[model samples]
Target: MDTGFFAPLLTGYEWQLSLYAAVGIAAVTLIGKYLVLLIPAFRAEHARNAAMRRSKMTKPHYAQNQRWNRRWGPVFLIAIFVGVLPFCLTAGSQPWWQMLLDIAAILLVYDFFYYLVHRFLFHDGGLLGGPLMWVHAVHHRQHNPCRQDSSYIHPIEVALGLGLYAGTIFGLSRVLGDFHVVTVVLTWVAFSQINLHNHDLWETDRFPFRYLATMSRMHHNHHARFTGGNFATITLLYDWLFGTLDHGHGYGKTKVAIRARSDASGIKKPPAEAGG
Candidate 1:
């Protein structure tokens, strides 16, 4: 809760609460990814993602995205551990219910702000002589983007994107007087995985899980069809509330819709689907 929380991480409650949450989440995610691969549905979803990227010929951008992610991803991790954890986390003062409430509030607040930022600042080029569009345009290159296209953005975008997520945590810290470490960690990890899943090409019509499926479709539509819609990150609630959520972009066959969108948006259309 104090200014210098980093010193405590090595030999204090920060180690047990914060690092434990992160490490446990990482272990579960890494192990669960493999475990889930055994499920036919999940395996097919992954295969669909890979095949979609290949069919759309997104290899060059995909490889470039990977390279940039590998470079900047570690910087992001350092920021999380050194900067964010210290700024937003406390050992374990808050009650479990309060921690849950804090996490929900943080996510809802972050998503609402991100919806505005993504739509205006990033999409329409909000600052610096309108050059943000040029930077954001790189991300729009892949009309039929998949999971690989998620982080394929400029370094400037990376920095600013990090700012928004971290800003939410630090900004809330002042208002809420420091959150529990587990609360911050779970909120951040959920924030991250949701972004990755947004670009995924999977479909799940099940209850709570179906929300992501719907969100993913909307995001793909943002890339492939309606470029100016579905700008929310964590949830589409803002999009719906702000009248930007677009479900009419789906035009039966996906490839045809994407090609049509490219022609309309002036992005170079790929070759016919016969061989594409």
Candidate 2:
């Protein structure tokens, strides 16, 4: 009953079974994120165009997003492994719920780090200014991003995910305990999937599931202006708590833009250019 004590929560479960379960969760979550967000978001765009009897959303541009993803997706996926696998290996013998909570706390910590890295480091002329900025710019260049396009990130940024999350687990486990590491890894895997789903276009009314809707809208706006607002990857609490959320940018506007991209070439033209 010692709250301060750190120990593995699972003893009856076989190590092999635990390893398999962790891998299975990672696989299912990965596929779920891609299919749920990218596929539906893409389909929604197509449906919108078809309903309007217009074919402005060209297949080539749509495919372009896919191409970028295909070329780079594996690398990004590797980051997931780099980030979660080691931690899982070290701490897979914990209570499932404890693992889940650890994952959540890790995600929150990493998300905040992401926000800081994104806002100050990526934006400012700091260490991330040169390489990270260039890589991320490819993403920003996509004015009207497809749902799947959300996966597009500079390899540099992708690398950070691996380092920040994995490195955190390593450092924390040394101080906290081995079982806690597994918990955090599982949580991160779940979070990675959630982030993927939220970024891609898929309608949902679920448990706010990490506040996906709010975060998705914020990211959409970031794409909207090609800059600014909604920096947090996992939760809006950071932005909301830190006075960074753009309340004026209503969800209505975001929906319109999303629908419009769906109806058009799947490429979002600048608002000014669209007007002219």
Candidate 3:
């Protein structure tokens, strides 16, 4: 394939091209993540699971959180689009093969740095005071998060997280001097899809993308009882390298650990495993 085969497609209208790409990414991600719900068997299974989970709930359940996520999700997506726009417009000129390589490197770097930011800065309450903690707390509220919950984050969290990510990518582009915009856009889409898949409540046992099942499982554990570990959103490389990868006690079953904050005491409990 010619390196510049698609160059003309994005030659003049960089911002508009980026916007269109973002829209396409959103469309594909939504359809891919929730497409399983269209399958009769999978839909029935999800329904049964939802029913069983609701039956044992002591508080408002999935539907409530899902609705809340849906309400605020578009705002979060717009924030992401704004955050990514600069990088997309400033993408460097590079050969297609080299651009692909750069994209892979950027993704790996983003994953590592994000794991650090997520675990130490966002989740570790001792490091920062009230406001920052509150940002991440919104995400943890829905332990059994649905697809919409993927982007259902506080604006502060979105600003910090995506800001850091975009800043890093731009910095790397400047240093390398040939990081293409197409690479950045592709990586952004992948990043968004992976986060969505991680938060999706659907079982992935028979999914065509079986390789991503590990990520799905690790993220589930992160939401379940092993919140302290498995902080990486896209890949387990950082978590595994740092010894924070907790696969949990059970493989197939959900660990019933609720992260609750006590209003009066201002202290939180360690995730306690609930009996199955």
Reference-based TM-score of each model: 0.75, 0.61, 0.64
Clash number for each model: 0, 5, 0
**Candidate 1 Cα errors over 4 Å, as ranges:** 1-22, 51-58, 125-131, 203-209, 249-276
* TM-score top scorer: 1
Error of 3 at 147 (Å): 2.1
From the highest TM-score down, the ranking of the candidates is 1, 3, 2
| Candidate 3 colliding pairs, count | 0
Error of 1 at 11 (Å): 13
Tens-place lDDT per residue, model 3, 81-114, is 5544534454445678887888788788888888
Q: Write down the worst ten-residue block by lDDT for model 2.
A: 267-276
lDDT of 1 at 182: 72
> Per-residue alpha-carbon lDDT of model 1 for 248-270, expressed as tens digits?
44332444575687789887653
Candidate with top lDDT is 1
Point out where model 2 deviates above 4 Å: 1-22, 30-84, 91-93, 124-131, 179-185, 202-211, 248-276
lDDT of each: 0.71, 0.55, 0.62
Order of quality (lDDT): 1, 3, 2
